[model samples]
Target: MISFHNEGGIMYRFIFLLFLSFQTNAADFVHPYPSFSEGEKLYTFPDFLNAHYYISYDSENKSASIKAEISFKTEEEGYPLFDLKENPTRVELDGKEIETPLVDSPKKETKFRVMNQLTSIGVHTLRVEVPLKFLLRYTDKGVDSAFWLADLDDRSFLENYIPSSFENDSVEMIFDVSFKISADQQIFANGEIERTGDRDFRITFPKEYTSSSVYYHTTPLGSFNERRFEIKSKVSGKVIPVIVYSKTISNFNSYEESIRQTMDELEADYGPYLHSSFIVYDADLSRWGLGGMEYCGATVTNLWAVQHELFHSFFGRGVMAANGNSGWIDEALASWRDGGYFSNQNMRERRALVLDFPYVKKTNRLAYSYGKNFISFLDGNTKMPIEMKLFMKSLYQKKSWTPITTEDLIVELDLFSGNSYQQLFDEYVYGNKSTLDASELWIEPNSSEHSIHRKISGEDLYKIL
Candidate 1:
């Protein structure tokens, strides 16, 4: 939907140069721009084909040794750039060591560009040795931080500490992680974990075709309870490994059953579950305001909120949006799946909330509420229930790991509903024009039975709404 054609202006000419620099042959390159204010700065994205990360952690010193090898193909005539927070100790291009690691500092960016040496346009591999310092913060059980390693009567990590490339599309990234800790420590990764020695361990994840990020948790031995189970896919007859990590072992079986049921319902509504495994971490977040967040195939939340985060596997992380503005595409679908809106009246309230704040750029209340309401209108009023299912499955299959824009979603909606979503989108979504006519939007009130099919408690539902 984004065009970088020749235009007679300095801005257009600069953009054209950036387009040339961001070329990729892996797939048709779709630039995800025209986002919020920060959108204009993101002129390029990595067409990441494959990557391998070797991480070594020293719990005693809180330092890390990270070595990464990334293979990608781009049609850009100039050097490829990467966003790395820490400076690498060594850099290599296509198995040859460059005399100096070319680091270009553009104005007003937290990221430094890794200059590439591409003599010709083809597949090339870049290797770098990244030194991580104090990336781990020690905290107590009450603290709810993304990446924390703590010794609160026990030493453990909250995972999500691994430094990741910014906004890269999903690809087959092989990870080989090694951790050195106390003799009685255990490492929990999002990948298949294996114990190689007394104080050494390795976790290798399968190629994630539906996720753009990878993460893991490391803890002292026996610090947390672990339960391993499996869920059967009726569509593929494949059984997937499921792991639960909780501070206590109480009611783990019930949690597993709930997770299984949620997966079953989602797989039935959508297609088969995309990942080979799923993990739930019932983390103690008594202090942090936020309760839950979703990772690639793993989640950090309480036992009761497992379904909400699991649904994210199909929406948030499974099918990525282009930017924060398009984040509603995932958040709204996930909220609807969680029964955030149950009736046409509730949909009206959601629309009113969006109309109240028409120009908020970042993902906030408007994104979730309006998103759920819009989908509810389509499914309940327009009565495209069957097409809705097909559209979701097809969209998921096509844009599994790639980021899609609002325009991209409108195209899909138009194809499914056989109607234009421009007016609705402009009013409620992209443009925030606030000129949508609700009387013309609704077709009929949904049946009471269909309208009140909420699963969560009224109290929790109200909180989300």
Candidate 2:
């Protein structure tokens, strides 16, 4: 993992490129990403249209109550399965109370309960009320945890923390989410906010969203200093609100320019920014571990990490990979774009550094690096004259706010570049039987050239020109 370094009280972001010469065996490492088997049949399910969410929490407490109204259309006279992480206290369909039926002897991979309800072949509405409470725990240093907090300063990660529909599937959802907190506390969400009452704050996502991408955060009113501004796109003249909140007032202004540049460049490269507002939460340096994480229209990170996560608003969370199988696609594309490695030399250098990393089921950092190398090769190498912008723009236009698979992306690649990537996946991405030196991805140094190439181990060489 990359560590945050502070020199002379100034934050310096460093990306670790080299692996240890003597490291633990791969089998000993704890894999971060989970692989689900077919036995876990109760995964994300149910296709819904719109939802109205009302969440109320107290900053001094660890529990919150949520009430949701969901609307869906059934294809036939069959029950639709709803996957919920939390248990529902009450369920009503079409203004009538209904029993919450549970599937018996569900698949072994099912982590949460699945509800199957019979319905007619027409539009139906359901109201669900679920009460959620997270165990409050402190870190090793005795400070409050960011994931679940109720103290002097507070923030709740409501994406998975709150009760919602399936997370992976792509469904058109219009959200009307409101929050009720202390009157003195300030809240920020994905949409426009209105002060409903002295202690109630409501945020409505009027536009259609690809998934249940609703996210909001709250802190004490005066806990942090904030800077609010707006930027208009030259391509579409669409304006977006940008806000940066931080504990210290030193570097929040610098992020405005960085955000504007990133937004403008991405809009020109991909399409438009889909969300209404952008928020950057500069948590304390002690919360560095929580930083660099992305939400729908908000992120919690330092200035440099802002651009990478913001770009995810276009790629990773923006395009919405169908499942964990294709999650690397967006991360790889984001890293490649952030690295600005658009030339053969840049691709070669990146490939040399990341060739040994595992491309399949690797930790997020290594997976991201390996992905960066793979997309860099496809986008920058002269052997494949694929225009990165055109390919991405086409993908964005077609799969915006939708879930996609690796096979689906490969088909698009063949259509655009007239080349098949099945072999590429078999060798690197999906297969792990061969090392970098034995694979065809390595660019061997020329013997006639006077360049110095350092050999790491066996046939592995780090080419230098």
Candidate 3:
């Protein structure tokens, strides 16, 4: 009897262990930073807070140097990573020469090694000094702006400035940046101004936040009227104050309603608005093709691209993508959401933009097509509601920490749909079969083309004809 009781106790313990393992696996979301092995933890800031900046530009050499200092409180020792302009001639951290890895081409990143030995568990300082003269690559078209110190290049604009890492505790960060730029140009950055003097401006983040960028132009531009709104978080009851800056006063009115409506819809869909404040600044008309770039809470966009950038707050800024593969996930989701809104409003022209994925894929053939088509398929596939939740959970748990692939989606579909994704892939992606019978799926009897109807709610309608 004693032996039997002991065996029963052992069985109970084994079952408990299995239950714990499942819970741990389910809870895993967002990849831990690479430094986890180095005894570091990771945390993300809210989407609406903008990092403060202070910059002073030098006009003589047409080159700029910067000194950035950010303060954050933490329980465990952590490090900072700064994406530097490729032309950096010299970089000094805490007055010491530190080795920086050549992580990618045309974009250079340097990691500052915080002294964990002497540093205690509390507040820390990260000081970075950069010399930008080395970045100029002169071509026949004069100084190529491609090498400009602040250009985001291929990565998301936020990653360009902040060091993404693992952290043990939450902390507020304040960034004080000083830059030297051409005297003829005007400079702008994130947040409400504390002061502006001596060809330099100082900005402040009202809450805990991560990165900042400087915008400069040679020609002086007149300021437009600003529009403000207060967006409240449904979950936290926190409110995010917003401001929109434009070149012409009239342009502010054009984008105000769209921005407000987008924010309303986003907060309704996503968990909440994460930042204490947000800003949208006007960019040069000539550089409008670049669309908008996301920083912490602040985004710089052209007049026409304001709506698309606003949606970034939910996907791009809120749910961070670790690598290139998952990069398109947020972008495609945002495009669908923003574009779907127009379609629902009976604006067929605006809705047509969402259907033009084929043309976009053709234009950028090398880019990942899975994100675009996966979203479309999700709309058509009934199991997607459950699958997306499982997929996102898996994505967060797998901690792939980089971009995801089409195979990842297939695995997810298999899990949620309880059917092999091979059939779906062959029918939709590989063109081996058709999604629906063309003759039966037409919206209008006279229309020749077939329209495949999506099974998901909140998806745009389709009529191939």
**TM-score of candidate 2 on Cα atoms, chains taken together:** 0.67
lDDT of 3 by residue, 262-339 (tens): 667666555555555677766433232345455445675655666666665554444443333234455556555544
Model 1 segments beyond 4 Å from truth? 1-44, 59-62, 94-120, 134-168, 182-184, 194-202, 209-211, 286-289, 340-365, 380-390, 397-402, 432-465
Question: By TM-score, how accurate is candidate 1?
Answer: 0.69
Give lDDT: candidate 3, residue 35.
Answer: 32
Best-fitting candidate, scored by TM-score: 1
lDDT of 1 at 144: 15
The CA lDDT at 445 in model 1 is: 24
Best candidate according to lDDT = 1
lDDT of 1: 0.54
Q: Candidate 1 at 340: error in angstroms?
A: 5.4
At residue 45, candidate 2 shows an lDDT of 37
Against the reference, the lDDT scores of all candidates come to 0.54, 0.53, 0.39
Q: Please give the RMSD to the true structure for each candidate, in Å.
A: 10.2, 17.0, 14.0
lDDT of 2 by residue, 1-465 (tens): 322233323222212112211111121111112222235342223446566777665444545667888775443344455544456888888787776654422322223333344555446787888764443222222211122211001111232344344434334333333333333656666667778777676776633343335545554565567899998977788888888887665556678889999999888888888777888776542222222556567765666578887987887667765444465677678777767855442433322222232222111233355666777777766766787778998888776666566767888888888988777666556554334342323333344321111112211100100
TM-score of each: 0.69, 0.67, 0.51
Better of 2 and 3 by lDDT: 2
lDDT of 1 by residue, 236-334 (tens): 788989988877555687888899898888888777787768988776432233346566678766765678778878876677654434656776777
| lDDT at 115, model 1 | 45
Instruction: Single out the weakest 10-residue window by summed lDDT for candidate 2.
Output: 456-465
